[model samples]
Target: MQINQTQSDGLKQAFSVTLPFADLEQKRQARLVELGRTIRLPGFRPGKVPMSLLQKRYGSAVMAEVADESVNEATRQLLSERGLRPAMQPKVDLVSAGEDKDLEFTLELEVLPEIEVPNLGEITLTRLKAEPGDEAITQGLDNLLKSRRKEIEVTEERPAAQGDAVVVDFVGRIDGVAFEGGTAQDVPVELGGAGFIPGFAEGIDGISVGETRTIKVTFPAEYGSAELAGKDAEFEITAKGLKQFETPVADDALATELGFEDLEDLRKFIKDRLQRELDSEARQNIKRQLLDALADRISFAVPPSLSESEFTQIWNRLEEEKKAGRLDDADKDKDEDTLKAEYRAIADRRVRLGLLLAEIGQKNGITVSNEELNRAIFQHSMMYGARQQEALDMFRKNPQAAEFLRGPIFEEKVVDYVLELAKVEDKPVTAEELAAAVAADAEG
Candidate 1:
């Protein structure tokens, strides 16, 4: 066997390999011998079958198998010898081969790029620190009380107020014909709540019980149903009843009703939960900031294959957002050229960061153990609820699925390890402030 290797680009390499006829003949002879040891065919006892007959019948099949294995083996050996780590699978092509000559093939692949992870000790980042605060907790408690609130029958025979809940039957039509989900009977509507279109809920206000009226509203331009989007519709409604919220007081009674012992205990539990939520958000914010900082410090030719993949992922997401009108106004402000340039830069950053993390992990011998993989599989399984065992079985049965699980786990571990080396400082801030910081980072 002969091997020749050369680089095509920063991360791409080409390998040409040739295997001698002697090796092919040896494999063919071995295959025939193995077949001779097996059971009888209809014409003769299998062990008594001649080697010439075995070669005549299975020679082509065996040769193809041997050729494939030979290419795969050579590719593996080349990677081992050169220490080249591919981002994805290596592509192999049969360069030249004949019935009884040298078997030849070429391998084309984008190897993982070499990266110098910089300034681990001097890199600065700040993790946002926050508690939900008194205002937020009070709002949360008020929400719970509101959830327990019921619609009490209105005593006064007067028009409905803005905050009043109305029980009504309504039939809405566009072009004088009803649409799906546009008709309902005895539905409860809280006036001024996030119900229906912009003016739909407000139109229900000031209607007294037993009144019948037509409420006209227009669907927004960005509505989900394309046919009905921006269309005007009139609803024929019969106001059956009017009611007001009867909220439960925050006391021991409310706690017992909520399956808790006392209001104080409930508040304490809620406060602790809220604190953890804020801290989780803070940690996530810091993680993104650190990634962005690391991206800024690095510049190298990302493996073109990975850059294309990253670009596709980001661009696909952007397309979805654009179609849904969910892209932020700031994003809309930029022209397509500008947006592409900015996002391309982002794709490059992500590819570079991925390369950096992988190189660092490899250099430090960071790897996911079998125990870690099993645990990850178990946790991922639990995400599917009662089918967890079935999902776990799937992971255990499929090597690729299990390997996919390792990538994220390893990535997170590497991020944590890098954070330890970086000069990350705690920055106490309000929820709004932290949100602003993230928003600003996103805008840039």
Candidate 2:
């Protein structure tokens, strides 16, 4: 076996590997022996098949398999000997191959940067002191109660009006053709809700029970259904009932229905939940400040390869945003040099911080444990309204998906460890001050 470096860049290595024919033949024969033991034929016994027959039947497949193994082995050996780590999978090209001739291939890989992490103690950061107040908790509780409040039927002979919810059956038509999701039966729609088309809901106002009417509406130009956009449609409606707004009183009885002992218990729960949110936000702010300070503390330049990848990712996003006319107002006015300098700086900082956190995690033996992974999986499932078992199965069946759950856990643990040694001061500041400080750091 021989490996020769054909080209070298800052963080890229291109190598050509050659294995003598003798070694190739050895691996091929070994594979053939294994195949013969398991392979059965009508005429040949499983374990007693002739080597010539095996070679004739499975030689090409065995050769390809051995070549793949050889490439993997040679690449691993090369990386280990040179103390290099690949940033991504190496691209392997089979340059030459034959039954009796030596095997030859070329491997190209982007190597991980050689990063020297700065001392954590030297890093400076600030953490804001804040917690959700009673007012916020009360507001949140009110919102929850409102969402769960039920609407009851109104027994009145008056005509349906705006701000009233009317029970009706309606059908919509576009160019005399009814499309999917264009009609509803006995549906309750709030007059002037702006939920339905502009004129459709208003036409329901002053409608009487058992009354049938035709309402016309023009779909918005940017409606999701392209075929209906900027088109006129008629909804034939028949009102069956009406309802008036009713909010439950904020009392102990209402709280009991919400699975709580009383209103006070509910308020306590809300306060606790709000405090957790505030604490999480505080941690995030500290982490951002810590990252920025760490970037300033580091002195070495990031590997050009890593920086290029990072910059390219950010640059591509900016281009996409520009095309959509969604570029930030502040960024829109900036010149190319200014934008490049700002974004390149951001890319450099992110790469440096990522490299530093990875090194720290490795040195401290920090790992993504199963418990943390389950928590991540559970949270992700909650985002999509999924059952716990369903999300777990999704993660377990897809190794790549499970791997995605690991990175954040590892990074968070490393951040916590660094914060332990870091000079993170709890500078008591108002919400406005904290927001300004975080925004300034983001701009930088």
Candidate 3:
């Protein structure tokens, strides 16, 4: 056996490997002997086949098997001897493999780049802190009460006004033809309230009971349904009745109705829940700052294969968004070349950061425990509601599906580990301010 380094560039390496025909013949002979021990030939007893006939019958098949094993073995030996970690599967090009000839192949692969873990203590980040105030709790309770508000039918004949609910039958047509999901009967629509197409609720603002009117509206450019987006449509609406909401007072009775012991208990629960949400947002903000700091401090060449894979995933998603007319505003004005360059840079950064985090986790012996992974899986399954058991069973049966959860858990743990070591200063702010900060970070 022999090996030669054919090429070396950045993170890519290629090698030529050759196995002498003598070694191939030896392996073939050994395999033939093993098969002979369990063989039964016509006109011969078991394990008594002649060596010449055995070779004649299985020589080609045995040699092919030997060639495959030799290539794999040689590749493994090459990687081990060279201390090379591949970024992806190595490409094998069989150069030569014929009877009584030396086996030869070329191995091409992009190796994982060496990553230098930065000093965690040197990284600086500010964690925004926010807590739900008494006013916030009161507002939350008010919102809850509104959700549970009852509608009282108006007895007197009158026109629907703002904050009033109106029952109506309507059919919408686009370009003079009715479309699917554009017609409904006896639907309760809240005047001046959300969840209606723009101008729809306002169009019915002055509609009186038993009145029929035709309202014209143009769907927003970013409407969810692509077919109706930016299209002008007319709705023929027939008002059925008028109703108003009976707003409930946020008192003990209301709390008990919502499954709480008392109003105070409900307020405490709301505050606690709000605090948890703020804490989650705060952690995310600080983690982003820490990652940005680390990315700035550390720099290394990422494997092109990894960057390309990440870019491909990002570009595919962008294409889907473009097709759905949901492309980001920032990217909408950019040409194909500009978008590709910008997203390619993002892909490179992601791969580089991923490698850095992995290196840090490896060096610090950070790992996700089985219990933590199970808890994460259980939480994920809970998202499926009644099908939670089915989701759990699927994860249990499909290791690959469950393995997808491992990366997030591991990355979070790594981030937590870094946070523990980094100098993270807590800055108290209002919930609105914290939200604005997060939004700003996301926009950049």
Candidate 4:
């Protein structure tokens, strides 16, 4: 057996491997012997077949199997001896293989670049700290009250105004033909609320009981229903009843109605919930800043294979978004070349950062525990609600599917380890200010 370096480029290496026919014949003979032990013939007992007959019948087939095994073994030996970590699977090209000839193949692979882990202490980051303000709590409470608000019937005949709920029978038609899910009776619609088409709710404003009108609306270009998207339709509406939401009073009565003990208790819950949200936002902002800082501090060539793979995934998603008419406004004006260039840079950065974090985690012995993985699986399954058990079973049965959860947990563990060593200064800001900072970070 012999190995020769064929090519060397940045993070890419190619090699030529040759195995002597003697080694190939030895492996083939061993495989034949193993098969002979279980062999059965019409006139011969098991393990009694002649060597020449076995060789004559299965020689070529066994040699082919031996050739495959030799390629894999040679590739592994090459990587192991060279101390090379491939970014992706090594490509093997069988150059030569035949009877009584030396086996030869070329191995091409992009190796993982050597990453230098930066000093976490030297990397400084400002972690935005935001606490929910009184105003925010008040707003949250108001939202909760609105969510729980009840409607009261208006006995007297009156026109439905904005914020008023109206009961109506309606049939929506596109091209003079009523569509599926287009007709309904006595549906309560809030005149100024969302959920209806762009102009459907507003068109109901000032509609009086017993009045009938045709409201025209165009579905959004990105509407969920592809058949109805961006199409104009007319709804024939007949107003039947008028109703108004009861004015909400944030008192003990309201709290009790919400299944809380009192107004103070409700306020405490809101405050706690708001604080949790703010904490989450802060954590995300800090992590993003940390990642950005690390990216700026480190510079290394990423394996082209990894970068290209990442770019392909990003480009595919961008294409899907463009097709769905949901492309980002900022990206809408960019040409194909410009978009590709920009996203390719993003892909390169992502790959580089991923490699850096992995190196750091490896050096620091950071790992995700089985318990943490199980907890993550449980949390994921909970998203399925009633099918949580089924989700759990699927994840348990599919190791590959569950393995997807490992990356995030490992990355988070690495980030947390870095955060512990890094100099993160807490900068207190309002929730709005923190949000603005995060948005600015994202845009930048």
Candidate 5:
């Protein structure tokens, strides 16, 4: 057996591995002997099959297995001996496959770049802090009440207007042909709510109960359904009932209704919720700033394959958003080449940041604990409500999904570690100002 370096370049190495035919034959014989002890033939008992007969029955299959094992072992030995880590799976190509000749293959792979985590003490960050203001608390209370608001049918005979809710039966047809998902009965639509098609809610503005009207709207050119894109449709709508929302005042009674002891309790809950949201946003902003700072300070060549993989993921998401007509305003005016170029840069930055964070975490012995993982998974499962158990089961059952959670958890832990070491000065800012700062950071 021999391993020879064929080529060496930045982060990339190529090698030629050769195993003499005799060695391969020996390995094959050893594997066959290992399998023979348990072998059972039609006319022979277990461990009684003749070598010649076994060779005739399974020689080719055993040789294939031996070849794979040999290649894998050679590759593992090469990587281990060099103290190198591949950025991705190494590519192997068979150079010679004849049984009578030496077995040879070419191994090519990119190694991870060496990274030096910057001095934590040298990094200074300003962490934003905001308390939910009185107005925000009042607004939150109002929103909470509105979420529980009941609707009562209107007694007055009046035309449906903005903020008025109405139940209607409607059928939409494009070019005189009904389309799928174009009809609904007793569907509640709020006039001028902008929940339906562009002109749908406006068309209902003057409608009264028992009135019938035809509303026309054109599907956007970038609508999710290609078949309906840019097509004009007429909806024949019949108003069935009209109602108005009745929100209760945030008083003790309302608090009791919400299972809270008093209005003060509800206020405290709202304040706490708002504080959590603010803190989360602040943490996110700080993390983003830290990432940007690290990117500016660190310089290393990321594996092209890793960058390409990251770019593919970003591109896939962009394409999905574009298909759904939810492409961001920033991307709307950019040509394909421009968008690709910009996103590629983003991908490269992500790779660099990810690699740096991973290195820091490894050096500091940071890891995601099982308890933390379980807590994170539980929090994630909460998003599914009634199917939370199923969501939890999915993460527990799939290692990859668990790793997704683990990665973020590990990264956050490392970030927290870095924060503890760095000088993070809390700068108080109004909620508006903090929000604007975050927005500006996002834009830049």
Candidate 6:
């Protein structure tokens, strides 16, 4: 066996491996001998197959099997002996393979780049902190109370207005022809809610009980119904009743109605929930900042193959979004080449950051435990609802599917490990300011 490095480039290499035919024949003969002991043939006793007969019958198959084993073994040894970690599966091209000729193949692959993680202790990050304000708490309580609101018939004779729920019966017609699902009876619509066709709810305003009006509306171009999309329709609506939200006062009774011990308990729960949300957001923001800073500091060549794979995934998703008409506004105007360039850069950054995080985790001996992975898988399975057991079964059966969950868990653990070591200073800000910062980061 011999290995020659034919090409050496940054994060990529090509190797020529040669294995003598004698080695291949030796392995094939050994395997065939082992098989002969368990052989069963018609008109012949078990373990009694002649060597000549066996070789004639299965010689080619055994040689092929042996050739595959030789290639895999040679590649494994080549990578291990040279300390080369491939970023992706190596491509092997068989140059020559015959009964008498030496088995020769070329192996080409992109190797994992050498990554130098930034010093965790020296990394500085600002952790944005926000506490729920009294106004926010009051508003949250108001919303909670409103969610429990009920409607009652309007006793005063007044026109329907915004925030009022009106019950109406209506028939819709397009081109003087009625369509399916265009009519309903005693439907309750909140004025100004915009839940129905454009101008339908607003047109209901200024109408009194028992008054009938014909409202015209044009469906949106992207409306779900293909037949009615961008088409004009008229609804003959009769206002049957008007109702307003009657919210309960925030009191002990209100809390009891929501299964809480008291109003203060409800407030505490809301505050805690809000605080958790703020804390989660702050941690996420800080993580992103840390990753961006880390990326900026590192100057290493990323494997083009890895970047290409990542770019392919991004481009595929973008194409899917375009097909679904959910493409981002900023991406919609860009030509394919421009979008590819932008996404390729993004892919490069992601690969570099991923490599850095992996290095950090490796250097610190950080790992995602089986229990943690199980928890992650269980959480992911919950998204399947009634088919959660089926999801679990799939994950258990498929190692690759389980790996999808492991990647994020490992990355998050690495992030948390860095955060623990990094110098993160808390900076208090208003909830609105924090939200603005997060939004800005997302847009940027």
Clashes of each: 1, 0, 0, 0, 0, 0
Q: What does the lDDT come to for candidate 5? A: 0.90
List ranges where model 5 is wrong by over 4 Å: 42-50, 98-100, 159-163, 169-185, 191-207, 212-238
Task: Supply the global lDDT for candidate 3.
Answer: 0.92
Model 6 lDDT per residue over 1-444, tens place: 988889998788999999999999999999999989988978778789998989999998999999998999999999998999999999999999987889999999999988877677888999999999988888889878778888888989999988899999999999888889998999999987757878999898889999999989998866766567689999999999889877789999988888899999999989988899888888778988998888888988999988999999999998877776667768879998999999999999999999888988898899989999999999999999999999999999997899888899999999999889889899999999888888878887
RMSD of each: 3.3, 5.5, 2.5, 3.4, 3.4, 3.6
Clashes of 5: 0
- Which residue pairs in candidate 3 have backbone atoms (N, alpha carbon, C) closer than 3 angstroms, thus clashing? none
Task: Give each model's whole-structure lDDT.
Answer: 0.84, 0.82, 0.92, 0.91, 0.90, 0.89
Give the runs in model 2 whose Cα sits over 4 Å from its true position.
34-48, 150-243, 299-325, 333-345, 386-389, 431-444
Predict model 6's lDDT versus the native.
0.89
Model 2 over residues 1-444: C-alpha lDDT tens digits? 888899897777899999887897899999999888899988987799999988998899898888888878988898899998887678899899987889999999878777777778977777897767667777897788667767878887889876689999988887777877888898888886757767887888899898999888898765656567688988889999998777678889988987899989988888888767667667778888787677777765576667878999999999877765566768979998999999998888888788888988998899888888878887887776647678767888886997787888899999999999988778786655666666776665
TM-score of 5: 0.87
Off by over 4 Å in 3: 39-46, 149-157, 174-181, 225-232, 241-249, 253-259
Total residue pair clashes for candidate 3: 0
Between candidates 1 and 3, the one scoring higher on lDDT is 3
- What is the lDDT, from 0 to 100, of the residue 6 in candidate 5? 91
Q: Which lDDT tens digits does candidate 5 get at residues 324-365? A: 777877899999999999999999999999999999999889
Q: Is candidate 2 or candidate 6 better by lDDT?
A: 6
User: How well does candidate 4 score on lDDT at residue 241?
Assistant: 93
lDDT of 4: 0.91
Q: Relative to the unseen true structure, what is the C-alpha lDDT of residue 86 in candidate 6, on a scale of 0 to 100?
A: 95
RMSD of 1: 3.3
